[model samples]
Target: MADKIPQKCPECGGSFTAKKLTTTCPHCGTKTELGIDGNARYAYVAPKPNQGKTFTATDLLNEFSAKHVSGPGMPDLMGVNKILKTVSINDVCPESGMTPLHWAIVNRNRAVFSLCLARGADASKRGTGEYEIAPIELAHREGLTDFVDRLVSHGASADDDMLRPIKEQRQVAAAATRERAAVVKETIARLTKEGKRAWYQEQVKHFEEILGIKSSVARGRGIRAFEKVPVKSLAEKNLGMEEWLIKLHDLAFEGGATLFCEKGLTVSSKIRLLLAPTKSVLDVVAVSNLLSPDEPGCERVDIGRQLEKLYVELPYRILECGRDGVLGDIRAMPDDLEGLAKRLLDICPHYGQTLQAGNGKPWEKVDDVTAVKNDLTESRGFFLTWD
Candidate 1:
């Protein structure tokens, strides 16, 4: 009995009935075999082990194109491997004039691309027609720096024309970094001028990170240089001290000091005021002798004297000093203490004056100008007193 089955001829595209799975197309007289779908349409049969079957370049091209469609899902990589085994990796498709590597690029099939490269695909080869570009140029156009680098490493010609765009991109990025660094520098300067020490320090850190350089202005220690004492804690010790400290806190906030405690208390038990811009500490007395009358080593002055010192004197000498004032420029004293002492005297030339460099340090009489200079140079801080 004849095993008749409907089939289409692969070469002539004619409909016919075949007597067997592997049979000749009666209409075209071409040797045909059943495809996987049981249709004896394809003229070629699957290759047997250890036997090479001849396939036209067009045949290999059509097979690769059909299997490597764009979009998600595993591409038929095994099919491509099989086709490449018979044809050269550089063989061009007659329809698209693109080699196997070019098709892998267009399809964005990384697996196929890697496979082609591993199989000695020429990185310098240019495709014809619409994709008439060398492999390195294509990778560069796609913004694949890794691919371009890899291609160059694999003997692709690194001509100036091929590398110009990458150079231009780097230049643009460098210019942008410089512009941002300039803006940060300006911000840091403005913050310093406004007496905003906490905010200023933050910007200084950011500025250093951007420019990769440590700033000289940032050499002074930060707010941590002052002891942190809460205004409420002081109030607990002396209820009457709270109101006066609150007023001072408000002034400090307006001047840009980073306050550690609620109501801006950064003072120690004996009352140390923070001159934020210079990172200097000033020792001040209580608002009145009544405020801390019994505390040892705490000078209790009359209310009028206290007001004059805290409300009027220190603000003018330290906080409100213009950007180029003596204290503003005195983060650390220069080696020439005599000149620094003269600068100090030029600012406040009052009689019976004394200057203390740090907390618990003995006050140096301003009349002995040399001693004052030495104290200023050593401590990097200043606390002025008058009898």
Candidate 2:
């Protein structure tokens, strides 16, 4: 017969006899153990490591929360892996129905979230209750574009519904930028016309800063009038070219000063003629200086020679306008030509017609012609010469 020892239940403090190394308390179902000695006292028995133990979703959440709070960067990855072994990565907490991924997002813990993703957490799984949305949706709602991108790379659906908000936001921002640019132009024009030279210079610097354009002032001989270069008769001319010449003449009467000219089809001469009244020559010098020997247009040994081959070409390119010595009316044009073509057509439909009737291909077919047309229409001025 087995020896029976008198013992007390460690959990409930109930008297009992321990007939085996491990015995259960009949009173409270608590397990107790006794030594081989007949006089050995009963003690609470801890189950074997991981024996009959189930790691629930709640346990995983608590572990992650504790680690997230205690650590600086990420939760203890080993601890997370241990719990993940027993608990499904997609398991939802009983109370919140939020998976570990959802919890990571809630805590804004990207490290843990990425770990969960790497461990096969379902990014497409929608949680219950307040977070009844997929991980990507939550990421998007939180304005985590990188997170959304990652989720997409990991196979999360980038449906139109999920991306519409970002597209809409970008459109709104672009519209605001355009509006703000217009306001800046108007203020600069007003300041220039009011003879507020000090304010105008400040505004011009501000405009240059906003547009990411370098500030340059024409520094050569300042001629009060521009010499009219006679061109082919209208019948033999590209009407677009004729219109541009007409616009330059108009700008001359409106406070523009001819700075210099290089009278030829050379790049420097063309840039000079096109930006004649404006102050973008310094821009040319700056661009020429920035060029490297390996660059395409920098093959010419001299900086001045290189400036002639630099990006600006015949007819397509036009002067960039700003407050510094640019015509007051011209200063009202936006620094960039993006979407300006439509605005130009809205303001001056006849200009588009003239570009279409020009000797060259229609503006739409030409790469930069629409941009030039837009600039000319907005400033009611022209500085570019056609080849």
Candidate 3:
């Protein structure tokens, strides 16, 4: 081969001596391959290999969307983190017209969602379906306040659309509920309805002795309850009972707990409960005793543990304050409390949790579940002079 010439790299305008057929610019890392004319071949950027095949931008983007929804780690494993800049942030889905960012938002993948937005993912990009949906609206519909904050920070408008699918979803849900209720009412004779109404009142009596609440659940539409007797209602009729109700609601808000209502067996009412966050602490003696009071199918002392590990990670990361205490916020950690049950569990997983059968049996699972619940009521006090 002729003596390799020392010259400025055409790619980066940097100096380097060309030796092998391919040599990279020392300063910029630009690979230059020897052409047929023995000159250098300059490509815009190094081609990425995808499973030993030529990687196209579309293939890269689609793959990213796939892993982004599958959860964290896969995207970084696929080297999507390094090529984020190269992939088109606003690459649209052929079917939904949603950008990769949209899928990230829909899946609550804040890491990839933030990366896409920072790299110029179009916030204004909306799907072309009948909904013409935007990510901000989707976040709002998901009832994810933190997600709304993030999208708003990224310049997404929060204008509520009248025709959004969420509203349609609500209407469909109400209609379905009404249809189902009508069939149930039609099937059951008038005598049965009256019988159920009486039975419901009796159940409420047992429920009150358990939860210690004056109950009425206000669904934002309005509060409705049977005047004679009520199930677990957060009526705030009694001063302190409302506070406990609020705290229970916050359990769902903070931890990955779910709140659900089932139609009362006899009456047209609903029974509401916050599913235990993790480790099925509800299985504890006191808690389960409270929940199962006179309720059929609820086996006492049998706690159901959560299937998935509920990890409470910090939010927005940039701004990490989550408190409101109104509508859906914990106004304040209860004034006279030893500690938050969740805080204790977080500090020591075995503290407020129920143990599994023969597993981790060697490890201590303290049975102080009710003690923690009591600590919630007992306000922490300060002491003074030495006696």
Candidate 4:
């Protein structure tokens, strides 16, 4: 019987330990002791260690009113206080259909209400009454504005009849919702169209070969412009970099390979299209120093040589972009750019070091193309070494 006996503090009516649980109420300052019948009860005297406390109806009610909120895993007010070792009122007034918040408001126990609020009990759950009334509804029906205000502040929606809608009201609501969606779609479409229009200009050219329109019969500068092959003409004529880039893209697909110079193909407008299936900025450096002033090399070597010149000059620029531990736009660059950079480095004797460094290898000084190419052929006995 002693082992089975529940140990509790009689004063505050909380659970207590065998050693320290034999004590008075810390909260209410009531004395506690065990009677001769070996049951616990509260008394005016200070609680002694051997005596247990017995609780009465008022004591149970006081405990229930004191502990309103569920602690930790408990969901509502009743589950928390009911599990406490001291109070028995939780069993007497166990919630059947109503939430703890509903019970708290219906009882109008402010201490329990405040405790329930502190322990995160939601005030929005409606009571189990006929109307499915929320705590505030009970408060409002019972003339409890303070409790209703408390519920409102704790995220309870003010509109109690919000769930119900008349047929006419629903029709209007649906129409307004659709109107808002339509406006959003229209705004998005308009913005997209405006952005596209701003970025690109559209043009249609007449192709004599495609359409079978004879060049002899063609008229005006427009027709003449359309008649000339883009790469051949651009390589021979003066074009800006941006214009050259556009024409170069048009030509790489149109023609396999073409070489241009500062003299014949104006320097500012020279875009070299490195690949056909993809767009990549392999490298673009116009070396006026390397180009022969008196004589031009054969087309193949000239193109290769121009590419080599770009390889030598562009490494420092790439390094600068990568210096802050980010390649920035280059890191997010298209796959084509990565491929083109690789191929361009592969063919150039001076570019091996650049490729290795780009791939996270330690940096080493790769001498300029003119010296490296000589060393490869002279000492290494390699015909086309990358570095």
Give the alpha carbon lDDT tens digit for every residue of 1-387 in model 1: 266667666566777876665577778676666544334433333322222455544555455434121212123455555666777888777777888777777766665677778889898888889878888877877776556656776788877865676567557655655554443344345445654545656644543353334544322222222233333344545444434444444444554442212112223343333334322222122211122332222222332233333333233223211111112113334566676566445434431133322232222222446656655666454433321
Worst 10 residues of 1 by lDDT: 320-329
How far residue 157's Cα lies from its native spot in candidate 3, in Å, is: 1.6
CA lDDT of every candidate: 0.47, 0.48, 0.41, 0.36
Instruction: Give one digit per residue, the lDDT tens place, for model 4 in 225-319.
Output: 12223444443267643344445335432442211221222222321221111111121111111222222111222333444454444421111
Runs in model 2 with CA error above 4 Å? 1-52, 68-73, 164-387
In terms of lDDT, the best-performing candidate is 2
- Taking all chains together, each candidate's TM-score versus the true structure is 0.29, 0.30, 0.28, 0.23
Which scores higher on TM-score, 3 or 4? 3
lDDT of 1: 0.47
What RMSD value applies to candidate 4? 30.5
Candidate 3 C-alpha lDDT tens digits along 1-387 = 567766455445666666676567788875555444333444323336454454334454555543121222124434554455555666565555666666776677666676677777777677666326787777777776556656666777766552344455556656655554443233223322332354434444444454555545322211112233233344345534334444444443354322222222123233333222222222211122123222222222211121012112211000000010001122334543444445434433433322211122211112344434443344321100100
Error of 2 at 123 (Å): 1.2
Q: Ranking under TM-score, best-scoring first?
A: 2, 1, 3, 4
Please, what's the RMSD in Å of model 2? 29.1
TM-score of 2: 0.30
Where is model 4 more than 4 Å wrong at Cα? 1-95, 159-387
* Tens digits of per-residue lDDT for model 2, 250-271: 4432343212222321122222
